[model samples]
Target: MFDTEREIIESKIRLCLDCGKCTVVCPVAQHDPEFNPRLIAQRRLSQNSHSPQDETIWQCISCYMCVERCNYYVKFPEFIHGLRAEALAEGAQLQCTHGGALQALQHMMAREDLLQDRLSWLPQDIELSEQSDTIFFVGCAPYFDIVFSDLEVNTLKGVEGALRLLNRAQIPFNILANERCCGRDLLLQGDREGFLALAKANMQEFARYGVKKIITNCPECHYTLKVDYPNVLGDTGIQVMHLTEVIAPLVQSGELSLGELEKRATYHDPCTLGRCSRIFDEPRQILRAVTGLDVVEMEQSREKALCCGASPWVYCGAVNRQIQDQRLTQATATGADILVTTCPKCQIHLRCAQKSRDGKIPQVEIQDLAFLAARSLDIGGESVG
Candidate 1:
């Protein structure tokens, strides 16, 4: 922890007494010993380790399990994120493949051609509430990129479904067409300046748009806006909500029926939403409301759920693949056909991992909750027509 950058972040590391509890509860360590949160915790505790070059740092899936499980209340994820940020700042490069992903994020954020085109996924018939109180701040992810190709068109079905639910219930909301990346990836990757710039830009946009409250479909975006934004924006008087929480009430009120899914399903808790923000029940409740579906629980569910392996501001492909495989293996063991997740990042990355694997491992379906809700739109369907 005596590293120049480590000491700078030491205030946050005030009292991590080498308790291996972080290790015990960490899925990265459980799935692969190469990743030991306790060891990282210990290194963070050590005062002499200069220029540590551990590949395991790149292996962290950015899952907040260690932080949540830490009895000492160490913000382990923050520590890890800080460590990664230091590495990037020092020009300490990981494999180029993962680095390239960061480059792609930079390119995406800097280019409106990529950003605006993705928004086309929304059904033209779907109404855009430009003057509403809430804005669903969809993050940049491969899932939404595919769906919203015309502005996330392929994926607008989910957003449209939620909007329909809101509209049917008369909830006022709108969207920011000029919204940029939430800077989560950059922030996690140790690009402090980059992150700050993106955050400031977004904060300005939110203020300009009169975005009193924000709802996000991506846990990473949700965590960035809800948890990190305030520290930088100085109390912008905005609220950040996960889509599940926003729509869970609708399902509970019988306003959004999930329709009948005569199949077994399991839910994957994204680290950003579940551990980062303590959001576990909302998504589960949304799933439970669906008719004819058996919601099975994997050995690791809720706070203990394994990470989908592509977050925390960096993308180490090999390690992430390992984590994703372990998660998929565990998910497959539950005998569930559909593995539902709320975060677009988790859904897209897991889908990429699922496609990378060979056949016969339960054709696990990965979908966002909004897709199911849209399918249950008893009233919105006629309106879309």
Candidate 2:
């Protein structure tokens, strides 16, 4: 398997025409000139040996910007994942942010029999069934709230927004009694076995509930369940849809009524939702449907949008801050009152960047798309609690 994987990665890298397009768009290379994708490809091609301890491999944020920019369609983010897997197999230590506490939490959740109170954040007004054919996969929002409390971000609000929308639309969905992390963090950290463990546990729970469809507010959860889970666990014959995809149609068809927002906002396309999953229009369409919400286009909107500068909860530093600051600058340049993003991770990272600045508060307020939708529906306030 390892040999086949290496060969596949090499085949992709072989298509590189020594063009510097990948480096030009790389977030890390923009700040840290030493970490260049073109050079990494050249070095990997020239050397017959594979080193799991390559520091440069972990520097990639897996934003897929290089893949988007590559004329030859080389999958640079996938290539980095392959390299990271080899490194992990060689007993290499990954540079995890937050002292690896979040990664540790994921590993701790792998136990199949562990019981969790994951639904503590479910609002009192939201109604869910004991069991249903459809399940709401609330991925790690509670954990994120606990871990990132210092950032003063209501990560769980995204979950609330999702539940509120479902309730208003009268869509019956069941919440998982024992949902674990989606294992995206582990997969991105190069822990394939750990990811598989979490995947198996989650799948077993899904099977126990006889779930046929899943709705998720988190893009990482949606991507992992819809795309990554099938790769390892075979097709579970389950359909997964992000909250934006589900809500877009409601707003578009007049099934769900949204009141006026009366604010100018710019949408930041989360890398997972836009570049990875190809969901570019639904969120914008939802925003456009609002009565008074003025949707402004950032210079880098849609597929060309920049990443939030952190991935897998690891390797965040000066370079990451620079990237986040630059993206926030671009958002502010639009003169929009708010910067709206569909992913919780994007909201947290951008909010953190906003707070870290020494001067006056950031001109633009960072918000999750779901929260805005909930506000328009008058189902819930902006706060989590």
Candidate 3:
């Protein structure tokens, strides 16, 4: 166990220039006056004392906004990640959203004897190539469908859409027969051991199937596979790609032509794909390719895109709802017929805000980019929708 506290203090927190910019732009600090990134930094560096158990450590939604605005490139979200790990190391219990069910599921997936019934939801029409080295990393869509059933969130729509598009284009790809969660939430919630176990299991599966490349629609899974794995485990010699990266180029090259969709839509940039990975254009490119679909931009988009209120599935409540409502309001402001995003979690959280009985939040139609695209795809020279 590395000294997360000491490392964060020395490498990131201590580099703070006492600038209050992080707090000013932080969504949490903006709402809760008690939370300040600058103050947190000061406390960590205080000669008197330091405590990772501070509530502020878990309040961060891990939006990467601080990293976006920091002049010195201080990774505040990452600092909190380290602090959360430190807190857990000291036996501090963290409240995982969804009653810690999702976290527990990830832990269970790490077990060697676990058998994953991951393919029951897969439709028969989308054929898989057993010989293909490229695999569609489904992430936790199957489990999410069960967990968020109350919200009626169909995360598998995106996965099915991805498969449909790939099949339409005659792209050979396979799905993991026994896939596991990417452990992004676990890692972000400071469960390093859990994350490593999942990572190890995933890596073993990848090697077993000779998976040289991964294509996933879920932004969190894409980010975890593409960036987080390499960062924590060194080079695993794999190419990780978001579904947008695959679809956009095919559309642009005229290999895949999308049918007309007479609807106005606004795109939500998933933090993982846009801000973190700098993948701003690929989704937009595919969206723009569809005929009759009027694309509108939200006021805060691209680098300044608002997060969908929660991440890593922990401690989500008022602040998360506020952020989600704010984002939904922005999407509504564009007069879009639908709010399209690449992240399934974004689809859920944004829609969850609209479900509130208070009716204060706007009830905008939310669709995953892949699902929307699949509905508009021209397969067999006929429009699917």
lDDT of 2 by residue, 1-385 (tens): 1343763465387799989999998988999988999887777667655643558888899999998999998988777777778778878888788899988899889997799877766777788876579999988878888888887788777688888888888899999879899999888777888988999999999989999999998999999999889977788899999998998998889998877788989999999999999999999988898788899999898989999998788778889989898898888889998898878898888878877885444548887888887877676555322
lDDT of 3 by residue, 62-160 (tens): 888888899988988888888888788889888877798888899999997778887898887788999999999998888888999888898888888
Worst 10 residues of 1 by lDDT: 147-156
Candidate 1 Cα RMSD after full superposition onto the native fold (Å) = 4.1
Question: What local lDDT does model 3 show for residue 99?
Answer: 91
Candidate 2 stretches with Cα past 4 Å from truth are 1-11, 360-363, 382-385
Please list the Cα RMSD from the true structure of every candidate, rounded to 1 decimal place.
4.1, 2.1, 2.2
TM-score of 2: 0.95
lDDT of 3: 0.85
> What RMSD does model 2 have?
2.1
Where does model 3 exceed 4 Å of error?
1-11, 378-385
